[model samples]
Target: MRMHTRIVPLAMTTALLAGGTAAMATGAAGAAEPKGDVTAQSCYGSARNYTGTPGGPGRNAHWPATGTYAYATRNCTDINLKVNYTRDVRVCFKNTGQCNGWKKAKKGVWKVAASNVRDGAGFYIQFKGANRSTGKIAY
Candidate 1:
């Protein structure tokens, strides 16, 4: 399978690498809404939301509904993941086993700026504890 990659801005990259929550502040304003096949896991109060184009199957209970989660303008650029939960949630940017770039969100809506997200690589969000959601960019 062919992988797609992109380039992002410097400021965004710097902020993400610094482990800052600046990306999260952006929220969903002017951001593209998630669209496509959305599958919800039966946990943490099952919910409904939009799904993007690139991702895996939608049955993994440990992960969020798998599908195209977000879109970016360029390589290493920024993709936003909007989290709407009622409590603090942990979001892992890439499924790298470890939540290395994971960010925490309080009760409310949050737009997580996933900076430096490369192509061939997708985005995944684990809400609550076991509800892991997945998405990717295929174009």
Candidate 2:
């Protein structure tokens, strides 16, 4: 009998790396609605608000039900987040359950509407511990 070694796929490896990237950030999300995906501020603001249905177009949509995003609370987990632009390239908490309300982001394609500042700003660390916006931005 011949023994075979199992090797993890490159895609899987990339995913693992991505999940471990959030903790390495050096900024925070703002409040009052994120202005953009790549802002100069950190997401240490109203990221939790991203999960609630505040009733509006700036909300995080609905997650898996009306979208694809889930819910979690990593506080600095790692995952594949992005500056979605389903409407205008918004900054979502791509951690894990971050942007589940919408579909998975496509390569070079925008998925989120736009960084409402008070709306965006959250994290999802690999489908675990997802956090929403905190509404701490000073716009």
Candidate 3:
């Protein structure tokens, strides 16, 4: 009876230790992975009213008022946009004159504006129609 009690406790302790070690290993592995898959390096642009008119000839069709540039904090492959209201918006690379097609983004939803964007690239929000806009940019 004494031997049986001692063996049972020893086995339980070993099993508990092994389970804990496995859990720790899993946590470590997860920590090493990329934090965000779609928006790895996200930068937020505060919500603000965009008071601008539609673009005309000689001016970009999607212009007038633009949001601040959200620069990539880490290397990323795509440029994403999100807004608080359903509006027509596009992402333009700073100083590159490269812009993506205007996409109608739903409120609080993420929309991919451009892909193959390099790290540290700066991008800003352009509106096709004027309205209050707010959201984030990530790659």
Give the best candidate by TM-score: 3
Candidate 1 Cα misplacement greater than 4 A, ranges:
1-48, 51-63, 66-76, 90-96, 130-139
Model 3, 1-139: lDDT tens per residue? 9999999999999999999999999999998787665344433232223333445544433322444466654544666566556677777888786877887878787676676777787776676643445555455
Which residue pairs collide in model 3, if any?
none
- Reference-based TM-score, model 3: 0.53
Query: How many pairs in model 2 have backbone atoms within 3 A of each other, for residues 3 or more apart or on separate chains, i.e. clashes?
Result: 54
Which model is ahead, 2 or 3, in terms of TM-score?
A: 3
TM-score per candidate, chains pooled: 0.33, 0.17, 0.53
**Model 3 lDDT, residue 86, Cα:** 69
Q: Using TM-score as the measure, what is the rank order of every candidate, best first?
A: 3, 1, 2
**Ranking of all candidate structures by their lDDT, best first:** 3, 1, 2
What is the lDDT of every predicted structure here? Answer: 0.39, 0.33, 0.62
Q: Give the lDDT of residue 83 in candidate 2.
A: 22
Clashes of each: 21, 54, 0
